[model samples]
Structure formats: structure tokens, C-alpha cells
Target: MTGQTPSHSERVDWLRLARTRQVGPVTFNKLIQRFGNAADALDALPDLARKGGRSNALRIVSREQAEQEIEATHDAGARLQIASEPDYPGLLATLDPPPPVITIRGPLVPDDHACCAIVGSRNASAIGLRFARDMAASLGRAEIVIVSGLARGIDGAAHAGALETGTIAVLAGGIDHIYPPEHADLYGDIGESGLLVTESAIGTSPTARDFPRRNRLISGLALGTVVIEAALRSGSLITARFAAEQGREVMAAPGSPLDPRAKGSNRLIRDGAALVEDANDVLDILHQAKRPATAEPPAEPYDPADAETGDGTDHDRLQSLLSPSPVPIDELVRQSGLPPGLVHAILLELELAGRANVLPGGNVQQAWPEDQD
Candidate 1:
């Protein structure tokens, strides 16, 4: 590693790579792995997109835009931290599609131990809210960093209870923009005492789709995710799914079956989520689980130029194998009778050209805009 941190140009490249259209978390990681740093990835983007079959020019964020975002975040008293930064949350960095760049407010404390995520319905019942608060407070006292989405009811209660010790609120919007409007004060408090983080650029507002993505970060940043009260189809369940996918523990607090909100937690319990009754239960589970360690390997140097292999025919074959329906990349390679790297390169080109969408589970599918269809 260089004695100096990555240069300003490199950080700008990282931001641009993150903001690039069709570049989701998985694709972003692959690009970084293939090209040593984001700068090289940015340089290689145009050709990559062309190989992906883009008829029109690809859209890449400009340096000016990234600079403006940096200024805005600094003006808001927050700073942007990339995944490889020292302050980046370790558990979150382990995620396959971890946020490449996150804006954070307040001091980024390094937890000596693993953190646990506590989340639930925004409209939690009185009892559920109290239970979440008490559990969070106990966890805080036990020196566990509490992590949650800064939503209403249970999430809010959890953060508030853990504030005295420490907590982290992962937001759906830009760090400067507070969502749900009503939680503006809570957001400020968190910025003061705890950590507030978001992947969105400055001034960006939360959309209907962003919250689920945010929930994944909440769960991804911890050793376990705890659902206090949630509906069966609520976003909390999505967090649980992400936790399970990332091989993190999923825990739920049971409630009376009579309440509609209880169904989510109860169902999770039935689905084999650890049954969490109190903070002790959480502590016990974490104690039995592996301790927090830096799981990332030392940064390896790479050259994007070296990654290029002449495989025009292979690219065409991979293109012919894709459909609107998402299919795992592994499946594509298996069916295409091509090397995995060649298949990946072809898909990367398609993605850059806006002709493909990479889905979870290493899936790649055709991305046909509504107008085109």
C-alpha cells in the first residue's frame, strides 16, 4: 500500500464509478478487482461499454459532479468514506455489493467487538417499541454498537436508547437530506452522538426503492440483524434475507400472534431465525459466533490493460445466451462454453453499454428500457 492515501483524483474516480449508471455493487466490486483502483476502471469504462454493445454513448459522472458532491457533504459537516478506508465498517465491507462510497456524520468509532442490527416496523406497537428500546439500551451497556435504519417506531427507539453509548443509523437518502421529515431532529441527534451514513449523493431524496437497499446496509454492517416487530412483507424481512445471504445471523423477537405486526417476527422465527428474547440472548448468540476480525485481504495491484483478452466471438456467444429474465453468471458461463473471465468481460461490456442488468446471486439479464420494449 502507498504511504499516502489514494490521491484526490483517485477518490473522484471512485465516486464516478459508484455513480455510473448500470454499475451496481457486484459490478463495481468486479471492476475494482479487475482494475486495481477506480481511476483505472473509469478509464476503461468507455471501451468496456462499447464491448457491451452500446449503440449510443454511455453515461459516466463527471469530475465536476463528484467535486460538487464532496463540497456539499463537507458543507453538511460529513465526509465520504470509501469501502477500503480505515473507518469503513468491517462487516459492511464484507458484503458482495457493499456501498462503494458512503457519506458519514459524527465520529466513526472503531468497535472492538462486533455490532448487531436492530430493526422493525415503522408503526411498531407501544410494547414493541419499549422492548426494542430496552434491548438496545442493554446492548449499548454491554459495549455492543447498535445499528439500525433511522425509521419510525422501533428503529428510532433503538437508536435513541443506544445514543448514550454508541449507535449507527444508516439512511436511505443523502446524509444531508433527512427522510420521513418527522425524524429530522433524531437525525441531527444521531449525527452529534452516533454515526449517520448513506450511499446516496448529497441532496438526493429517498425513493420508494431506496429503503430496501438501505435496510441491506443496516444488516450488512453488523454480525446479526434483529427484527423486533414487522409485517410479513415489510422491508425488515428484506434485511433479514440480506443478512442470511451474507452468512450473518438473523434473529427475531417474538410477539403475541394476535397482533398483525407480530406475524413478520413470528414467521422469521419459524423460518429458523434465532429467537431473541432479550439483550442477553443477543450477547449469547454473538459470543458463540465468530469474533470480529478484518476479513479483507491485502490490496493487490492490478492493471485494466492486462485484463483485456481478445474474445470477440465469445462476447457474441454470451450475448446470444442472455434474455430479459435474470440468469446467474455461473449458469451463463456453463451454458456458453466459454471461460468464466471471458463471460464476465462480455457481461461487463453489456452492462456498461446499458444493455444488461446484473441482479443478485451473480445473475445477469437483459436491460430493455420501457421505451425500447
Candidate 2:
């Protein structure tokens, strides 16, 4: 509708819209697809949120905040990599709502260089640590890049072993912040020889909520994920789950059945993940892994030409079909007997309104006003 802006200005607008209130990656993509540009989407959020049944004012990150975040990124010796950039890792782009923006420090390892994630419990055993380190070193020697959360236990050990070769530490906090406090030196080393990555913007601190999201990135950036040691309840399991959902190979090293830290890995092996004892095992599995061709995301969130004015009727149908449980969007389209474009429009409205949670695999889980998390 107007003259095109320069790429730098375009990036700024993209960051601003991505940092906006109620605009998660999926929502952000949909908004861009529907409205045609970030500036327009940013202009439209207030009305969108109001229609979603929000009472309080929307809290979009301001231009000042976005600018400050970019400045902090530069100050920390990192740079922002947008999803649309050729420099962005290809494997990561496979996720449904691939990170819209990522801050990277150190060398940008392309997804073509095989990457394997080695993660497990933070409170790891000495033997577990040793095994993780050794496995990482061997993988590195084989020219495979290691990826892990920069947490304690297996993650740190993995990086330590692979530091000389190459590794990536995906952080849960801002690109500038380090969690657990003790890994400061390790963080520095990785930033020098390896890479540090995060979806968090500058000045943000890590929270319990951030780790699961971080774990997803760790798995996503790799061709396969290797769980060294974890309890039945651990973030490593979550990463493995993400690997499975993303159609990547999920591998786990066997541990003593008696050790609680081994339960998760053993379970993974039992549940169909490849059992990897050494780097060779992982290499073999990865070699055999089909490694599906990454699908291109829709250029438009939906075909706007097919859009119809939706109201209470469409909303009611969606509500009846949705529950606390997450279901694929395709199923909703099928069951509701509604046009896919109309379903997307209604869902977009509900998402901005805070009545829905868009999960991975194009599934959506509804949130009742009474039980909003």
C-alpha cells in the first residue's frame, strides 16, 4: 500500500510486533499473514485483544523497550537472527511456531552440520557426567556439533567436553543473563568457541516457565536429542517429547535401573527411542534417521480471500469442539463443518482475547475464563 522501508527498519518493526502483548510466535505469524505487515498488526492488537474478552489494557512492549533490547543484545556481543533470515538454523525452523527471533553469541552453526542434543537432570551423578562428557567429545571429533541447555549436570559436561570442537548452549534467560550463576565461566567459554542462544530478550531473567521453552529449542536445533540421565520428571523428558513431535530422532543412553536419574532415559528407550551407548550409536541412528524435508510455512496464515465474517455462531461451534485438552486444528476444521479460514479467524480472535492456548503441531487447547493459567 506504500513505498517499502529499508531492511533495518523492517527488522525493527518485526521485533516490535513480536515483542507485543498477547503475540506469541503462532499469533505473530497469523497476524502477519492476515494483516500483511508487522506495522499493521501492531496497530491492530488493541482491537483484537478487546474482542478476545480482555478487560485490562493490552501490554505490548514499546518501541523504547524493543530498541533497548536490541541495544543490549549488541552490548552483550550477540546479534538477533530473525526466522526469515538465511542465517537462521534450518532444523529450528521446523517447529510449528519456530522462534520468531533468537539472540546468538559465538559462531552461527548452520543446521547442516549434524547437531545432537545431550541433556539430563541438573543434579546429575558423577558417572552420568563422565559419560555425557565422553559422548560429547566423541561426537565432536566426528564433526557433529553438540547442543544443550546451559543447565547444571549433563548439559554443562556436554559443553565442556565439546568446547574445543563446537557446541551450542541454549539459555533460558536473556542473551545477557546466565542462570544457576555457577556456569558463568562455562558460558563465557562457549560464547568464545561455541555458540550461545536464547529466545529471551535483553534484561529478562530465567523463570521456571522458561526452561521448557528452552528445552524445546535445544531439541529443535539438533537432528537428534540424546538424554543422558533424567528422572521420570525432568526437563530432559520434555525435550525428548519435543524431538518426537518435531520428527527428529530421540536417543537415550542406558543407566542403572536402580538410579532414579536413569528412569527417564530407560523409559525413552523402552518407548521406542534409539538406545545410544556411545557416539557411534548416536551417529548410526542419525545416519539411518529419515530426516524429513523441512516444510515451508504458509506464506499467508490463511487465504484471506476465503475469509468470512464470523460471530457467535462460529465461536460457539469452536467452543463446543474445544476443551482443556489440545486438539489438532485440522480436526477442529473437520468436526465443526466450518471453513478452515473461518475457523482460523475465530481462533485468532480467541487467542488475542486470551481464551486459547496454541500448542505445537498446529493443535489448540482452550482456556476457560474461570481457569485461566
Candidate 3:
């Protein structure tokens, strides 16, 4: 939880701050903590970026643009939801800062309802598709919601099987931007019955980079992720990795070793993920593990005193110690011999300047020129 349910004006400010360039999920949290609210953070961006070594002012998303997004979302018959709302999924709400805002179509289920992600090869084998379909159908019958990236093959099959029940399609692009063009009918079906969720803004088409972020939401919304058939390089594995990092169950449907499509799932099994033969196996694990008691998102936001003011020399020294390789922030504090608060402040500024990357688990890395591009 981040703060109380936002008022109409607060929601607009939130959208603007989030849509601002170089303001990622992690930075969004840091900005809120440092500035006490999005409006203040929005006002501070120019000064902060200049202090962080930017020659020109940072491009903050405008209030007019934010307002247009709101209107367009309304026109689409969808609603824009902030993470602090009660309808926002708990599994996502508990993530650090969570997604600041998401555009959603259809109804949102309560956090207590079970959500399991089924993902695999977009070029799935017939047999693999059948298994995924059956598994999703069974899980749907048990009142579980299926979450998947609405790609072709296994994902489409899973949605089809669970159509009678409820499913959530997390698009790689905007909630209104349907990728793979062929799934337009399926997309409509979901909006009418299931839910369509996306962090991307209206009218934004997805690129290669968008899928990984989309994969994270697939796993984040679910209690577990199920891999039906994935090659060694399949994107489904990325979703499983996110699930594991999020402290959720990772389940895989075993496939024969001879099949290349099975390699990822098989390797996952060897690495200690649960082997799920069908939806029954998944339900059993859910029953046994049970959902952890989720803490409500904070009603009172944390405002860090002076978390953005830092010495320039000390900040440079800290930047010199970091590379693209992930290093713990605590280690940077120790090695740079800078005060922890100063280090945090410097990192926050660098992030807003697009000069840093904060990995999960309290790690930080330098964003190389290529990464910035």
C-alpha cells in the first residue's frame, strides 16, 4: 500500500509523475518518499535533474496529457486505477511502490481470489496447447483466475479454456493496444467478460522491450505461474523468474526431454520449482501453501527528510564505483565511505537523471549509454 485512495486531482498528478520520462517504478517510490506526494515531485524534477548533472531540463509529462489520457480511458469504457485502491490486486499492491497506475477493463476480482498465470511458447505444439487449455479450464472451474500475456498459442488457448469463468489478459502495450493483431476478437471477449490490464498508456504500441515488463505483471497478479511448454529461450521463463522473486509459487508442466519446447520447464523443475501435472496439482500446492496474510498498503506515506539533497563530489565518487553489474546499495555506501542518507539521496537523483538502474533486492547498477538509448 502506498497512500490513501487518491482524489481526482491527486490521480491526475500521479499519472503525470508516472508518465514523466526516466521515472520508473522504483524511482516513483523514491520520489514519493522524498517529496511527500506526486505534485511536489513533479515540481522538483527540473531542479533535481539539473543537480544530477543533466544540462537541460527533464521532460515531465504534462497535466494536459494526463487529462487526455483520463478522458480517452473513459471513452474506452475503462477505468484508471491507482495501486492504493482497494480493488487493486493485493499481490501487486505489496510490491515495493507497486505500479503507480494501471488502466483496466472489466471487473477486478478481490485479492483473496486465487490467480494463477499460465504461460508458454507462442508457437506451442498442439499437444502442449491442449494440456494448457485443459489445465486452465480445470483451474477456472475451481474459481481461479487465469493470468497470461495475450499472445498466440498457449496463452490464447488458456484464455479460451477459461473464458466461461474469468481470466485476466495483461497486454504488452496499452490496454487498448492489442498486439498480434489476430487476437482482436479475443480482446473484445476479454473486455466483455475477463479483464484487460496494462501499465502502458493509451495508444502506445509495444516494442520488444515491453514484453518483459508485461511478463512481470502476469506473475505479480498471480499466486503462482504455470509453464506449459517453453523452449530454453522462451519468454515464459522470465515470468516464472518474476514469480520466484515475488515470493510466489513457481509451477511447471513437465514435458518430454526430447522436445525443445520442454527444456525450460524441465530445467525449472530441476532447479526446485514444483512439478504440476495439471490444475489439480496446482490447487493442491495452493491449498498447502495457503496465501500469506497480506499487509494493507500504507495509508500514511513515508516522507524521507532530506533524501534528495546530497554533496556533488560524494555523488560522483559513488557513481564511479558502480558499473552495469548489480551491487548492493549498502556495499556502495561502505565502499564510497559516504553517509547512507547522502548515498540514498544521490542514487535517487541519478535515477531521475537516467544514470542509474536499481535492481530488485536493494541492488543498484549504472545505466550504460546503450542501456540509456
Candidate 4:
């Protein structure tokens, strides 16, 4: 299993890096590229954190702590798969801010196994729930892995229908922790027959903020994300957006225009997402798309040493370029006359330092304190 195994030390360092304060997925990738491995990255954290203007010391996970997490995960019958591993989901790796590590339970049949993401509102209508369940069952029978967040209503129905065939639950919390407390049994069933995956460390509780991050993985791990029912401003819409961004298919089941739950999906169709009536609709599309023989390798890694450093004077100039209003990242790069990677790295550092906030469209805004009239 050495081919499938990430060295213990490597795993420990990855866990340490992931748990570090002010280090998000983007920062994590940068650090990994800068320092060839997580061990070196951990060693360099204090200096980098200081350079990023972090006043508090960086938190690094000890070997013992990581070992305990591994033990807990194994005891829960789950395995840890780092992003670089062969078994890591190919679809997920294509995301810009992919999870560095994910804890998975049960069997993952590699990329060849057909996978579909089913997501919808937690309080779905009865018809929506039935449609999702039936679609999931049909997909399961066809040997497709049904993927969903184990929430109530539609998500619950989908998992229930796919439980016997194959299903994967992508939780916002740790693999050992079950959210929506009532789905505890469903969680157990999936763990035994399907798979449960999470990016959070063992014992982490699901928070409202974590769910959006989790939604990305739900879309990332599948060939397409299917929305059965959702409100205009629901998490399912967020998943569909991520799906679109990742170049994965976004399929939405149509519902009556009068239903508020249908508004999110209807708008998706209007915005160019494919409309789906059932599992066959999803399969038909997948059949038409060319399947690559292997997962595409990750893009060339970012190099921090190549980053252009702005002195105090340049820093002031860059700061002056910002406003309370967010601007596009490309615009910032053009306006600052800096390399795109350099600007991104600097912006990330400022963000860690609590001096900047990232906005949509790759824009950056000066944090309130930095806003000068």
C-alpha cells in the first residue's frame, strides 16, 4: 500500500499546515510550492507568518496530535487521502482552491466510477424529495456513485435511495463528526456501504461558514452537480456555481415557476446550466463528453521565490491602489504593474495580516482600518 500511502511525517506536516491559522487553501498551495514538501513548509511557517504580519505565533500541529487524528479516523473506518494521492478525486483536483487533504470512508472506486452530485434544499417539498430520491436510485442502479451532503429533505432522500448501491456523503464537519444530528443513522449506513468525506480535521464541528466550503467539494468530486430544488439564495446554487467554474456539468431538475424552491434552478437554466428531468438526462450528457484516459496533472506550481517583493515604498504604493470598493484582481495587477503571481502572493499575505479582504471577481479591498478617506 506504499503507493497509496502518504508517509506518516508528510501526513503530519500536511495536517499541521492545514490547521494553521491564517493559512487557507490558496496559501497552503503557495507554501507547498515554495517549500517542496509540507515538512519544509512547517519549518518555514513562523518566518512566513511573521512576513505576512501575523502578530500571533503560527499554530503548528505536533506529531502526537496528528497521530491521534489518524487513529481516530482509522477507528471510524476512514482513510486520509492527500490531494497528491492517486485516489484523490480527479474532478476535485481541477478546482482552483481544492482541499489539500480529505478523509474518506468506505470504497472509492477511482475516477472510472461514474459519479453525480445531487444537492438541494434542506426543506425541500415532497415532490422535490421524491424526484431526488428516484433519480438517485436510478443512478445507483446504473453503477453511478451518488454524492450528496447529508442534510435533511432532498439530500436525505437521495442518500436513502442510493445507500444500497453506492453513495458518498461530503460533510462540512470532520469525518468522525455527523451534522444535522438526526442523520446519524444515515451517516453510519454510508460509512459502511458508501463513503464519507470531509476536509476538516477529526472532531471539528460543522459551522454555517464551513458548509459553503464543503459545497465546493460536493461539486468538485462529481462529473456533474444536479439541483432538484433550492431557493434563489441557497447553498445548492453555490455548488452549481462552483461546478460551472470547474468546467463540470451543472444539471438542474425543473419545477413549477410558482414554487420558490424552483427559482434557484430555473435561474440556473436561464444562465446556461443544462436542464435535467431525470438520471437518464444526466447520463446522456456524460456519454457525449469525451473521457480523458487519466486525470490531468496539476498546473505548474506557483513559485514564491519568483514573487516580486515590494519594499515599504512599493507596499505603500500598492496600498494606495486599493479602496473600500473591490476591484478585479486582473485590474490590480495591471494597475500595480506587477506580475500576476506576485500581486496574488502579496494580496494573500496582506489578507493573512488582516489588512486586506478578497472580493468576488478576484478583487481585493483594503480592510476597514486601511481605508483612508
Candidate 5:
């Protein structure tokens, strides 16, 4: 969400680079920063992967494959929005590394629009469901766009309440592949009235790893995230965590102490998340909020001299300091007594070699054999 819309051929190169194996959001942004464009980034991948000690060349998506994906998106009545495009959501552009490209169906909200996400247990209680629905409706009446994953209980009810106003459904699968088949009708309704979004290709199905990515976007798209009836370990809490990390407001509805479904939300309130009883509480918080600034690309151009193609000496020195336990990248720089750029370069190579895991919140851990699976 920083640059102008890419032309047709440029868009295909973006897709090809984005779909290349091992190129996550962070890597994609770094490649763009290093090379200045997707086509050049695609050309650099094999050499970069090899420098990291990969035995085989990196597997990059072919131009034909990328073109087919673009065509399929159009066939499904959706359009692709690159992060640099003006049409990408403004709030989402604030993320350190937003989705490089997203497939969107329906129209996006106006640039000045304020969105609040409502997320919670899929097995929520009756009272919890009612509160989510009513809260979403009240906020919608105030012209706030509601955002959520199209799940069973709270998400479904929230979407139903805000359908007439505006809403956005961020999917874990392809925009066309509706999960929880029971919500097919709701999915259709949103497609026509609200926006449907996903970072996956047209034929990709939801997997265990995809939901967290979807949750990140749920929080990234909004100004704040509200949780209701979440358990101690649930996706709703994950969404709220992302909200907080992204400098967005995090709020949770109070629930009974005895209910297992209420444990997470109650804990959030205990841990200093704003306790809310209704949409008014959310509005009060939003009234006092300052919108986040858009994230900008790296200022300096790529310097080959700075991105040193390390020899085994540097790689081995870094490897000796790493363990299976997750540690901050800053700590790695301090411990290894190496320049930050060299540390990052080596770490990226280690990641492409399947020897390291670059986690959210700027953490890294050595990847185990099972982790590769």
C-alpha cells in the first residue's frame, strides 16, 4: 500500500515473485527493497538461496503460472490489489509488511473509512452472540465498517448485523472457497454487498497454517479489534494480539467467570485491555484514538557491497549461536557481534535453506526436522 498501481505486466511479475517458495511477506518486502522491482527480485532468488547454502536452486513460480492465477481471479469476479497500489486498505498499509498482493471481491471502503473488527468463539453462547450482533449493528449505524472472518457464531452474527451498512470478510482460503459450508449463503451476501479478501491463489484451500495469516489481516484491516467469548487458546485472542502489536486498540466484552469460553476475554480485561459493555465503549475509545501512519519502503537503494554474500565463516559463526529456542533478531546481532545487516542477510539465507524459522514479532528459532513438515 505505498506505491501506485502496477501495470499489467508488472503485476504478473509481482505475483510470480510473491508465489515463489519460501518468499513470505517479510522476504518479499526485503527483495523489493533490495532490487527495486519484482522482476529483478525473481532473478536474484536462486543466487540468494544458493549463498545461504541451499543444495538446489530455489523454486520460483513461472510467468505462465502467474498469468493463469491473474486470469482465474478475474474469472471469479475478483481483482488483485498489490500492496503498493492506491486501492489497498490504508490501515493495512501500516503493517510492517502487509500482504504483498491481495485478491479482493466487491469494493473497498473509502480511504477515510474507520473499521473495527469483531472476533470471538465459533461456539459462543446465546448472550455472547447477541452482544456481538448488537454491537456490530450499533457501530455500523454510526458508519463504522465491521471486519471479521466469516466463521460460525460471532463472526456470522456480526456480518448479518452490518450487511446493510458495510463489512469485510477476510478468508483463510481462496475468496471463492467458502469454509464451514453452512455459511455459503452469508458468503454470497457479503460477496454482493461487502468486500471479500484473501492472500491465497484462486484454487488454494484452507490449511492449519492459513488461519493465523487470515487473523493477522482481520486486525490489520481495522482501526481496532474487539473480542467476545474467546477461550484461553483461540483465534480471537490471536487477532487481538495482532491488533495490539500493530498499535491498534484492543477491547473485549466482559463475560461470566465460570464459562470456559469467557476465559480469554476475561484475562484480556485483567491484563489491561479496555473492558467494554457495548458499542458506546468502543466508540469512546475510537474517539480518543490516533490513526497509524502508513509504512514506507526502505529509503536507501540496494547496495551489493552492503549485502555481502557471506562465506562459510560468517554463516558458521551465526549458526553456532542459534538454538531451537526462539530469540529476538536484535539479540542475535548483539551476541554474534556482527553488523545488523549481515545478521539479517545470514538469517534470511538460513530461512531459505530451511535451517531457521523467522517468526512474527521479530523472533527467530532453529527449525527442527518436524517443523519442516
Candidate 6:
């Protein structure tokens, strides 16, 4: 909620807290809102996790490790951009729970230049790839910045089309690591002429789990998302979903019913996504798309003096209510008859202990160690 420039020590603390195990973006934000700063939150994690039922010591990234990560990021020619900073991307800031720390490898594109995400299957058909590239090029010429994950097929084509004008490749790995290694040249070119972004830390490689998190960022950075060709379970659909959840436009290029890759996009159109035939179609959507206003600073997490740590009976009551299914926090508040603040505090503890998954959009699900992949 504050815009004061963080000190070096503050930066390290932020990174440390952000890198702590089980502390995802939503949890991190909650901790910050409650504690007002990362240093205090880092100090509080042990007790929090213990209350949440962790049998082992909660793994918190050490100051030394965090420092090494900063060093590694610098060595890779990238810099950390914290969410509280004035320079953080405006569109990205509007996300309900934006990444606390993201590593950027290029100059910040101005907020005035609208961005659109183009995503689709990694195994795009030839015709689909051509459409994606041409659409991106035309959008670029019209002053829209293209955003995509630098994968094979449609993603690569989109980036290549917009590379000269402006493009952003959102990586699922560290700024230092490249996935689909064949795109080394494309990665380098984008870093030089456009921008590269990621939530991953230095030296961290992309895993299957990372892409969905990365997809959210792709949609978060843009005014809208356009799906070129995607299957029912495509990652591109994930990006479009995120765009819709963030209140941004979701557009899809219609494809043949016979092509499996088109199913997702076609389904999107059927479900009310804007139909995109060409760049002009996308442009028309953008013309009507409302850019989010500059975000107001978030509310304080809670007042420490007024907060109450619930007793054992209250904890047991909440535990009995939470099954493996995801439930809205408000439902927990109502069902348990606990104060909203106490419920969140308990949930934070459960999340830290790895006993629960605190997903985006305020959903919580049971997550025992055995349940994790």
C-alpha cells in the first residue's frame, strides 16, 4: 500500500519472504497487509506455520540465499521489480494479488501503449501459426504491444511478428534460464528490442507447475488476451481465463471444427468471448476495452492490537469444515461463525503449514503433503 522506495535490506527481506516455502502471492500479500513489511512477516512465519500444524520447521529462504539470487539476477542482466515500487507495470498492479517480486530483463514499456496477449497450443497448425504472426504484426503496426509465452508454434510466431515494434515474452523460468532451448535467439532478440518478464527467481528452471502461474502474468500484463488456436486443455485457455477473471477482454480466432487445436478457441467464442477474425477485430475490442484506473493502495491487512488468535475449539471447528474441496473464505467465515480477520489468520497459518492451498479468487482447499505432486 505504500510507495516508498525500499532499501537494499528491505529488498532482500522482500525476496526472502517471497521465496519462502508455501508463501504464494496471495499469502504473501496477506502477510504484508497484516505485518506491513516483509521483515516482520519473515519474523512471524515460524509461529504461523506451527499454529497451522506443520510438524517440520517451515523452510524460509535465508537472507544469504536471497542475496545470492539478487546477485545471480544481476549477472544475468535482469533487475528485480517489486510490486510496491512506483515503476511497476500499471496493468499488472491491478491484479488482485500481483507478484511481489518479478525479474525483468528489459526496459519498462510505457503504460500508454496498450498490450494484448496472444496464446495458443504449442503444437499449432501451419495455418494457425500464419494467422497468429500476421495478426500480431498488424496489431504492432497499430501501436499495440504483443505479449506471449515464448513457446513453440503460435507463441513464437506472435513474438516474431511484434519483435520489431514491441513485444513481451513472459517466461515460466528464471530470467537466466530458457525453456524450449531452440528459442535462445528469439529470447535474445526480444531482450534486446522488447522486454522479458518472469516471476521465477534466478537459476530456477521451468516446470509444468510454473506455466499456469506464468499464464496468469501473460494475461495480467495486457488489456485483453487473444487465443489463436488451442485445444480443450490448452494453456492458452488458462491465459484467457485469467484475463476474464481480471476483468479484461478475452478474444479468440475462430478455427475449423475439425482441427482439435480450435476446440478451445471455438468454445471460447461460444461462451461469449469476443470473436477475432483479424487484427482489426482485436482492435475493435481494444477500442471498447476499459483500461483499469490507477489502483488505490490496498487496505491494511489487519490491526494487530485488535486481532484475536482463536482458541483450539475454533481451530477444530474450522478444520472440520475444510475438506479437500475448495471453499470460499466467506463461507468459512459464516459457517464457523468466526470473525473475518480470525478466519484469515487461521487460513494463513494452514497455508504456511502446507495443510491447505490458498488459491486465487479467495478459495481454499485441503492440501496434505501426500496430496501434493
Could you say which candidate leads in lDDT? 6
Q: Put down candidate 5 lDDT per residue, 1-373, tens digits, no spaces.
A: 4777689889999999887657777777777887889999888887777776778666789999999998999999998888878877788788988898888998656355789999999999999999999999999999999999999999999998999888899999998899889999988988998899898888899877679889999999988899999999999999999999889999999899999999999999999999999999999998888898866555533346655756777877887777888799889989988777777788777766656766666777775563333
- Where model 3 places Cα greater than 4 Å from the true spot, the runs are 108-112, 292-309, 324-331, 368-373
Per-residue lDDT tens digits for candidate 4, residues 1-373, read: 1125577777788877776645667667667767767889778777655555657665567778888888998887787878766667776666665688888987755476778899998889988989999999999898888889999988899999999888989999999888789999999998887889888888889766578778888887888889988889999999998777667788898888999999999999988889999889989977665432333323534557634464445445566798887788789888889777667767666655555665422456775452211
- Global lDDT scores for all candidate models: 0.80, 0.82, 0.82, 0.77, 0.85, 0.86
Per-residue accuracy of model 6 over 295-314 as CA lDDT, tens digit each: 44345354454235676577
lDDT string, candidate 2, 1-373, tens digits: 1123337766787898777645667887777767877888888888876665667677777778778878889988999987766767778776777888888999747565888899998999999999999999999999989999988899999999999889999999888798768999999999988899998887788776568779889989888999988899989999999999888999999999999999999999999989988999999988887765665656546554543466666776787788887899999999998888888777776776677766656888875453242
List residue ranges in candidate 1 displaced over 4 A.
1-4, 110-113, 292-326, 334-338, 365-373
Cα RMSD of predicted structure 3: 2.8
Q: Name the weakest run of 10 consecutive residues (lDDT summed) in model 2.
A: 1-10
RMSD of 4: 3.9
What TM-score does each of the candidates earn?
A: 0.88, 0.89, 0.91, 0.88, 0.93, 0.93
Predict model 2's lDDT versus the native: 0.82
- Residues 1-373 of candidate 3: C-alpha lDDT, one tens digit per residue: 4447779898899899988767777778877766778899899888777676666667788889999999999999898888756677778886655788888998756364788899999989999999989999999999999999999999999999888888999998888898779999989999998899998998898877578778988988888899988999989999999888778899998999999999999999999999998788999987776463554333433235544455677668888998977899889989988777677777777776778866544678896463353
Best TM-score among the predictions, by candidate number: 5
- The worst-scoring run of ten residues by lDDT in candidate 1 lies at 297-306
Off by over 4 Å in 4: 1-5, 110-112, 291-301, 305-308, 313-328, 335-337, 351-373
* Distance from true location, Cα of 263 in model 6, Å: 1.1
Model 1 residue 10 lDDT score: 83
